[model samples]
Target chain A: MRVSKFDRPYESGRPERHQLRVENISLSFGGVRALTDVSLTCEPGEILAIIGPNGAGKTSMLNCICGLYHPQKGRIMYGNHNLARTSSHHLPKMGIARTFQNIELFRHMTVLNNLMLGRHVHMKKNILTALLYWGWAEREEIENRRFVEHVIDLLEIQHIRKQMVGSLAYGLQKRVELGRALAMNPGLILLDEPMAGMNVEEKEDMARFILDINEEWGITTILIEHDMGVVMDISDRVAVLEFGRLIGIGTPDEVRENPDVIRAYLGQDHGGRS
Target chain B: MMATTQCGVFHESYRSDMQLRPTTWQRLRVVVVFAFIIILPFVASAQNLRIANTVVIAAIGAIGLNILVGYTGQISLGQGAFLAVGAYSTGLLMHYYELPWPIALVLGALITAMFGAVFGIPSLRLKGLYLAVATLAAQQIVGWFVRNWDPIDGTKADGAARELSMPRALFFGDKLNDSEFAFYVVGMIALVIVAVVATNLFRTHIGRAFVAIRDQDIAAEVMGVNVFQYKLVAFATSSFFVGLAGGLTAVHSTNISFERFTIDVSIEYLAMIIIGGLGSISGSIYGAAFVKLLPEILRDVGLWIADQGWLASGQLDQYLPFAEDAAFGLAIILTLIFEPEGIVKLWSDLKAYFRLWPFSY
Candidate 1:
């Protein structure tokens, strides 16, 4: 809420972090319901995982919270603001950032540029200064780039920092996407299936990165992952959805023992993917 | 802190690491090219200077157009129309209002920026070919207004294009009387400023927002890039350059006419960016040079053929214009068919191939 200087450490660095509260939000496309009366609170600075089968409206739920999809029914609140009224473009300015289900990086740009782009909301705008690359623009650029370097370091993407995002491997692209979201320095991060296509080693790396993001920066993470093993390993809490409804929401062990969650998700597939 | 560089080179600070031209070799190349540019006027004839001015002006305009269609992925068929706005605005300001040429030129460009933003409004709802068609409306409307409005030297007949002249620019009370050479230097300066500004823009977050929107709009929006705002900014920025080009055309040619900037000119601008390279800044200049030079080269070749007795002079004259037009069409087709990425990519590939000479395949 304090909007003065652009060069604050990160949104997560701010002391007054607020939790995301989604209240009875219902979303549907024609007759097919994407999310039906789904309501859950994302606690500040915790890695919360939402796991379900395909078309279970996990991304839709994220989208509604992201302002990409406005729920037809109830209010989704991020701190003091009602997200229904907040435009999607202003989400990052409000300290909210999300990565996509598929890698949605600026393909032609190098990894550095993509990460710097995540700093878009924070960058001061002065065309004359930017064009001349002097004073405010030059000083601002080096400062933000210093932050992006930290992200590249955190994600261990030092080697591919200058490589074009398109030329990078799928796992690397996903990590870069996460790096981009991290570059925003958001208090809350929505990651849609960050480990969908990764191999086991890649998955483990992504899991560690996700945990580091949550623990070190205290970035509240709402991760949608299908790999239950990875999900249970990293998530502080688990929310299970089936056919557009939340079957259960609790700690990983509590969700694993829930009767409905067992029948719907864990029973069909033991510790691996269903 | 230590930083990585080409084996021997090292960057010890962020400012050093983030330099536009970090290496000695790169700095030397820039200085050498600038030195050559400074000496060019002394050696080149007036005719060559005139032609080079045209190419430089085209490059400026192409850079603008490329920012919209090529970099930002917003197709505009109103480039020529925007050019007319610049030309006529500068022409009217200099002639009737008697404003200083520099002030008039800047005002003219700014005026065209407003016009571009007005036309770009529809882009929020339209895209691709649909957007192209929408922009074409600007070409028609501007063309119609110039042909009908009396202040702009309107003519009753359809093909009768009236010329509106602009006064010569006075620099420190000097008339800039070196003529073609003066215009060439001015054109080169403008080209350098525009190119450098664009290059600087792409390195920052503003430029990243434009590319992000182009690559993926939804992601850009969610990532906090105001998509519609940036699209309008692209339109206005591109028009500022294009309008500057048009204003220069008025001052350089000393005459502005509707006939000179028709839809054909708009298409030519599009071809320049397309043949140069999409989403590449330097590609705009390359494309502009190729397109503007194609006709001149064709004419010279045609004249040579006639002089060599391969074709009669009278017969060559009859088909020369047709040949030039056909060559333009053919060049675009050939470029698209072979190197769809355009001349920029082709030039880069050639450099890469030759980097490891003789022994390499």
Candidate 2:
């Protein structure tokens, strides 16, 4: 099989020329290989979706990219920096932000406060200044609040900004989680199932928001989602994973026509490519 | 134009636009409390004032424990250890070295904060039951070491043991033998600590991170909070205050012993936080006062009952034996069962009901 023309241009930017590069990564937990030789490339201003079945290490791959779990083998390169050696706390400042599979919003904090936490890395004022809330600290606080208000407006969650996150509806809570990640204003945003348990209309809305975030903000997005239709619609390129290995990587149409991807999804031989 | 601007200004001054504090009722309450504290020594008996001083000292300890256990959700049974460190540090400095009172107090807090950080390192790595055991072990080890150390007891004989002694006072080159003066000092320190704690908490990122880690550690980590660093900071801050309270306690009393800073004292502080309400500044003070004064009240009742002619004094000793301990245990169990949120919740609800009396649904 030959690489398609549309896929070739995307491949030129592979691993080396991109903002985040995951090369031949493998991770094992207690004798169980969670990820094996999974390689993916994410560039600036692109939506790269990773589609696979459950336990295919989609989230584990994201964890490795964000420096949560150091892969047993392989390297993660982020803009001339080796992610393997970088601390987890430094990842956010390095322009990498991620959300969880289960919504991990700070339930007790107000929606505004939760978003404010995302800006913790950027807030420069120290403890003494913050205690006084005068001089540079007050200015910093106002600037951060203005940025957070912009995020709240962009997500259309202004009405519930003061309300506790735990009291919001599930769909609204998911939106607030995205707002929190957006507050970081990262170069690459990792979304772990952004529209997991939503209705069709909600999924469509989230897909539009994801596309808007990529096109308008020029932020690269690496999304792990199971809904192929939503992934196919929003993603410029998609990677298919089966048993922690990359089975297909191409444009949506080429991946749709791949024989291995078809087998991985349908669990049987399909005459799409062969 | 003037009329329109006046109307806009009037609208801006609506009831909902009012500030959070210094309400009419709150102002009156503050005035009353200040007056009560000022006049209390004159009206209350000396024994009663002594008990009040104990409550104030316990309040200081409870506030410190609240920072560790209430806001940060770290299980710490070594608060009593920090207290002992502070008391002994102050005692040694004032008695042996003849340091000034203010300098001794500062040194006591600093030494305790350093010790707290050492214990906090393991606490950051281990949590829940393991953390509890670690702090409990600290309490035991520190208590035993201080009790057995010959220099601390000021005994010249190699094996002789005695209770440690604290200097009466550090100011004016004179001792503070009066109970009233001790009461005033403890009360002033307690008031200042509560104010500072109330102001600093929730104002800085450290405070918010402590609360965030308490609610969800994983989420806090994902949000770029250094959980280990914040946990250690919580321990250091909490223990420093505990040490300050210990120093005040040593000054408040004539003598100190290992028994005063035992695991039981730690449990008593825990009970104060639990019965007062977790995560509330006012709750710590309330719990401390209730736990400290309840026994004395019960003892008075027991004495009155013994004199009621229904029971002879000799028989009363047998029947109502250990009345103080029994009351403390009963109060803890009853508070847990009926008002798990603690006395703070009850106070809040009462105030809320009054505020929204006619409109409450």
Q: For all the candidates, what are their Cα RMSDs to the real structure?
A: 4.4, 7.7
Q: What TM-score, to 2 decimals, does candidate 1 have?
A: 0.93
Docking class of 1: acceptable
* lDDT string, candidate 1, B299-321, tens digits: 89988888899896599889888
The pairs that clash in candidate 1 are none
List ranges where model 2 is wrong by over 4 Å. Answer: A1-18, A124-140, A270-274, B1-35, B155-161, B170-177, B314-321, B359-361
lDDT for each residue of candidate 1 in A1-274, tens digit (9 for 90 to 100): 1222243355444425688888998999999999899899988988899998889899998899889998899898888888966789988878899999988898988889999999888897766677777667878988788888888878889888878889888999999999999898888899999998889999989988888778777789999998889889889899988999999999999998899987885356566855
Cα interface RMSD of each candidate: 5.6, 11.4
Which 10-residue window of candidate 2 chain B scores lowest in summed lDDT? B1-10
Predicted structure with the largest DockQ when compared to the true one: 1
Q: What is the TM-score of each predicted model, taking all chains together?
A: 0.93, 0.88
- What DockQ do the predictions score, one after another? 0.47, 0.19
